[model samples]
Target: MDSIPKKLYHIHRFDSRSGLELYLSGKEDMVFGEDFLKFPMMNLHYVFSRGFICGNLLIDFSIGAFIHHLYSASNIFQDMIIMKFNEKCSMEVRRWHGDRTGAFSWTHTKTSVEELEGKSDETQDKELNLKASIKHIVTCNLEEENLAHPLVLPLADCVISAVLLDVISKDEEDYMRNLEKASNLLKIGGHLILFGLLNTTYMTAGADRFHMMKYDESFVRSALSKLGFVIDYCAVQRRRNVSDLVDYSHVIFIAAHKEK
Candidate 1:
């Protein structure tokens, strides 16, 4: 299987050397980087792997890219607000917001509003009607079904959800079902971003007790198209080599927009 793609082979070879190399190799096997402190470097590598710039900067380049894309589309200049669901103690979002000032409302299963409030004073410099300026909201909701939640499709301009359809339900219909629910959340011309582990286990955050539905890029793209989402951009993120203590592999990021 590994011999098919020469690029994959080179990635594996380069990943066999240092701690970072080992981390990338492990990502290919299904392990996330353990050290959150290294996320800045990890994110930099992620951007670089996607064919972007290289720098030790801790700014939110991901959000910057997203914002640039959004700005190019329209002229909404109010500060962008992100309603992040299920985000851990990751600084990617905050780093993306930076000191420019904006409102960021975060929701997670493990923390309280007070805890999130402590971090809000610095971010909420001005309040814009959230439903207006936010061009996208990326979520990591890997649930069995798209449930009736306040944060569903009807509430945002765009929603990005990561669902492991195969491992969680083992039925293609189940995957489609959830995908439909996600699509209904958008308006006539909103966007939906979907990502999943390809041919890998259902594991995350140091836990290895769940199931995962494996998928390839073609399968995901077809599924999205069936649900009325036109593919805008799709790419495979090469898992980085972090350290020899663990092993993992890669995942795919797909961006699709609803057609009017």
Candidate 2:
């Protein structure tokens, strides 16, 4: 299996919120961060508009980092469950959901969602909807056979996993193991919304470095197919800005469904 050495990485020490801010709002950032914000949100909006059912149970395995996708997903699905691999990510999500002070504000994401929907004046309403839609936020181990151990969660209709596998899996085999775990949590014919970096090996959070499994578009399709998922929609965007934070060549998104 082709991969990077884990000895040089510190994935658990990653700051989820700060990373989101840097990727989404940093002026010096030339990366396709804006594309990240727009592409997924727009696709979700189109999915909703087409009367696509996101199902009653929506499991977000995104480690609760950036809420741009979550905020959009909230409106279409009820009983939303978010999971994180570590305590910091879980706590940060709880703070935001609980409306606690000093929560990392997602105002930019909110504004972007609203403007895209042509309902810029409906920010507060959307916030309320999001708050109400989230049923729980908990810690999860993506590497585990059961992501959330000791707490058995019902199979979900849709699972959103973004920017997670790349950083979590040390190799293609580990990536498939984690992906199978996520797939096991989904009901038959359930959808999997995946987002990640393509051909990227590493990322930075402050001074800490982390390993990301480098992979390309074909790998995504082949892996999902091997896992018995039919690729529904797939797209990729090239990076706009070169930054020291990461070395990803393209941003990839895939909408797939379990076929058997």
Work out the TM-score per prediction.
Answer: 0.45, 0.91
CA shift at 183, candidate 1, in angstroms? 0.6
Over 4 Å off, model 1: 1-146, 149-155, 163-168, 204-208, 242-249
Model number with the top lDDT: 2
Q: How would you encode candidate 2's per-residue C-alpha lDDT over 130-207 as one tens digit per residue?
A: 878888888875545787897899999999888887878888998898889889889998899898889887776655
Angstrom error at residue 69, model 1: 15
For candidate 2, the TM-score is: 0.91
In TM-score terms, candidate 1 sits at 0.45
For candidate 1, what is the lDDT?
0.39
Residue pairs in candidate 2 whose N, alpha carbon or C atoms collide under 3 angstroms: 30-241
lDDT of 1 by residue, 1-260 (tens): 22222221111112112322222223435244322113222332233334322211111112111222222111222323343322321233443345234323222101221232343453232222222455444443434244433344333455544432433345567668756756765655655655455655333222112344555677788888887778766666655545333223555666566774
